[model samples]
Target chain A: MIELYDYELSSDAYKARLLLALLGVAWTQRYVEYYPRRQHRAPEFLALSPRGELPVIVDDGTIVDDAQNVLVHLASRHDPTGRWYPQNDAGLTSQVSTWLAFAAALTPTASAARLHDGLLYHHIDVDEARRGAHEQLAVLDEHLWFNEDAGWSWLCTVDQPTIADIACFPDVILAEEGGIELRTYPAIRRWTDRVKAIPGFIAMPGIFPA
Target chain B: MHGTSRWFPVIRSEEIVPRHIAFVQLLDEEIVLWRADDGALNAWENRCPHRGIRLSIGTHAGSEIVCRYHGWRFASGSGSCTLIPAHPSQVPPKAARVRSYQIRERYGFAWIALGDVEGEPSLPELDGLPHLTLRSMTFAAAAADVAATLASEPGIVVHDPYRAVWERMGDAAPMLLLLQPESSAMTTLHAVAGNDLTGAGRLAFLRAHNAWCKEIRPRIVSEESRSAQASR
Candidate 1:
């Protein structure tokens, strides 16, 4: 049985979880509730991922820390003729790759901006991190503008869900808590809703009960 | 999540340049983009705690960030509700603040987040290669579903795609997959370089790749059960 660390607010963790569901892969979600104390840096959590990040998938006695790596492993290990991952779709692959990188820029920036804005109460003001988040959103806006009316289904196509959406969806959507208005970019807003419409899509934790 | 007036980057900061308003996207919530008068940037949750009117959409009068719906002004630095148009004589409580974020400039750009994180986000390390800004679009699937599609493909050209945008460049950059979940939004396309492929040639290769994505990425049929929150 595959086991994943439980995290209510981590989009990275969702990436792995979603893959397991798509494959009907049996797994357990272990809640790592470390509040009032940064348990991610603790020894027990550190054993899972030295970086103390979420979406660490433990499979076949191997612990995978990074989110994309876990997805790749699942696809490589599970898919026979590679249906979920087509061996030939280069654009979809590149888009997924790009979106993952984009997530790196958007997640912390948006969340941090929310903090500087004082959206959440407890943690904040570590050198004003939110500044980077808004800029990141602008880049996304530009991308949306470029293809606003293309009617492209996925980040790469119009038919199905791509790794591109999974790679970037979690953190981008969370920007709302930090006071980001997602409605500005029509394409982004539409795209986000489409992702949400997907079956089994989970919501990020709100700015309470943490 | 994508309506124009519904989610706008309210206004540039007095100290912030026009080309530099951060996109504060709230998923089904009001958004207000703000920058400081002293280059100390701050974007607030569009909803004001007192009346739920947007504070970031309004103009700045003196040091306060005001609301457009009503002339309620909150101090940008502290998010304190300072002025009430209906009751100008009243002194609002300390909690009369709009949700806000820490904004700053870095790497020829600005970033935002919701907490006092331990450190700034480090950029992704990549294999050296001239980059190409491939198309960016959102999909109707989860990051896992998307990643599975990419990994499912051992090679980089999926013909008969769903809907892809192909660049006209002729060179093909080696495919490198990076699923960075920390930063929000959907997938990112990082171009890889291998051998003596010309820039144009690499672009062509990417174009083919894009075509595959738009044409053939899997159509995920999600289930109807809500699980606990997770990541990309």
Candidate 2:
């Protein structure tokens, strides 16, 4: 069984919980208080993950830091079909890595805005974060629009969804909490709906269940 | 000027995938558009009557739409409240219903009439010819301003208060522009090409037109601002 350092309201932590549920892998969560308690920065938690991120998975003595790495680790190890990560296909694997990086880029912009608004992290420059988020969202919307034209549903070229979709789902879905409306991005809105309908998918604090 | 009485394009027909709710606005009136499994299209006010929550965020259950809150189910077409999970055995009140609008599907676009509409939607002639729908563009300028600007452009074949038809030169096909007034200060422009395109041809057309639209948007918006400044 994997032990996850989790925070209930943290979107990064929800990424691990979502993949674990989807993979049908039982995991125990060691809850960390991220907001008022600021437990993520605690020395004890920082010892496990050097960056002090909310999601750090310890699976059978092997430790994985960061949400994307945890997703990569779980999918590659547990999924018998290998469809989630698709390590066999080099092109698909490269595309997934690109989107995972994009998801990480969203943290400082979209997720930081959310932290500022909801969690009272007032130090974040919300206007700059919102502008950055919109720029990235426009790129994502165009990509998804072209994907729709190509008869593809998920983010990548493949038919089914991969870990990339899960990685990007949280920030996009919870964007409204940061005062970012999705009305302009019709394709992104539709993609979020598809993400919600995924099998074994669950909603976090601000996201709605399909 | 385009008034509330006229029908306007809300979305492209191909964009409204089944079991998905599309959020659109007409003159600042928010609406939620959804399609049923039986191929019926619905446009209703974007609020759930139970709690005034946005039905746009609700779930589409094939023939019915389920509200995200309180598990209220409203039937298609009629938009009547059919089920309330808290009281499954009892029937919902008569007033428990969603306000629906009159909608029509034509010319690769879904059109809606906001107020009391009497006749068919006024549109340019492209009925029999196969056409391609271009990506819609949203602008900060008013719809009337956008329409007037498009009408003033060269090669205009036909013109109306809210619709414009222009003859394109070279590889680009004839364009049909429809302006939808979302609010006093916001508008969305939808376009359709009067040519049947497929495969690489279609993709090329889409990319070209999309880029061209993006290019013209800033000019239109800035032009509006300049005119407003002049008037002021």
Candidate 3:
């Protein structure tokens, strides 16, 4: 059995939960109170992740701290078809890697803004975070528009969504909590709908199942 | 400002896809537009009555727009509050409703009448010809200034402060330009080209006119700003 050190409201943790659910893998969640109690930064939790991240998954003897790394581990290890990680296709692998890195970039701006507004992290510079989020959203919107024009869906050129879509989904869907509106990015809005319609999809607190 | 009873074009009809929300601003009022699966069109105040969050961020669930904040769902056409996810067993009160505006689809545009309206919305003459609606573009200049600039172009006729008919200098079919006043300093232009041509010809016309609009937008804004500075 896999044990996920999870925080309910954390978008990073939700990414791990989403992929785990989509993979049809049963994992027990070790709840970590991220707010008020701040259990994620406790000494015991810091032992697992030196960076004190809320999501640290321990599967069998292997342990993964970062959310994206956990996703890679699950897909590469468990998915027999190799569709999620697509290790066989070099081009698709590179595209997925690029978007996964993009999702990491989103954590500081989009996720930080969510922490500031939703979780009451008053120390964050919310204006700068929101501005960064909008810039990223514009690039994503343009990319989605071009994809739609070409009759393709998902973040990459593949017919089925890779882990890249899952990596980027949480923050873009919940951006409004951070004072970032998706109204201007109609293409991105449409892409979110496509993401929600995926099979075995589960909704977190902020996201609703389609 | 025109009378509140008049209908204004909020967005193109194709924009309000089924089960998707379209957000547009008209005369300083933000409007949320959606089309139900039953083909009913709805225009509302773009806000959830519960928490005043913009309903444009919400999802369109076939017949209703569900607010993202607290899962409050507003029914299509009526804009009445239907279900509160938190209180599933209890029915909501009659007063729980978002203000809905009268909407009409004419000439490939969604026309919204903000206040009490009388007759049908007046639309530009297309002579019952098949037409193609171009992508709407926004300009930084005021509606009047944009309209004035377009009217000054050769073979262009201004019907009013917000409507104009343009005759291309060559063999292309004439087109109509409708200006939507977004704010004191912004305007949106919607164009309709006559459909006498098809295939590559139609594509050529659309690209040329689209480029023409793009070329004129910055010039109009610059000219208008210069005049405003001189007046000051």
State which docking tier applies to candidate 3.
incorrect
Docking class of 1: incorrect
Each candidate's clash count? 125, 0, 0
The candidate that achieves the highest DockQ relative to the unseen native structure: 2
Sorted on DockQ, best first, the list reads: 2, 3, 1
Q: Tell me the lDDT of model 2 at B157.
A: 47
Candidate 2, superposed: residue stretches over 4 Å from native: B148-158, B171-173, B222-224, B228-232
> What interface-residue Cα RMSD does candidate 1 give after superposition?
11.7
- Candidate 3 lDDT, A1-210, residue by residue in tens: 899999889899999899888899999989999998999899989988889986899999678888888889989988888999998889999999999999999988999999999999999999999999988986787567556545678889988998999999999989988988776566777788788888988888878677
Candidate 2 on A21-111: residue-level lDDT in tens?
A: 8999999989999878899999999998889887999999898998888899999998998999998889999999999999999999999
Winner by lDDT: 2
Best by TM-score: 2
Q: Write the per-residue lDDT of candidate 2 for residues B41-91, one digit (tens) a residue.
A: 999999999999999888999999999988899999999999999999999
C-alpha local distance difference test of each model: 0.53, 0.88, 0.83
- Structural similarity to truth (TM-score) of each candidate: 0.45, 0.94, 0.76
Which scores better on TM-score, 1 or 3? 3
Better of 2 and 3 by lDDT: 2
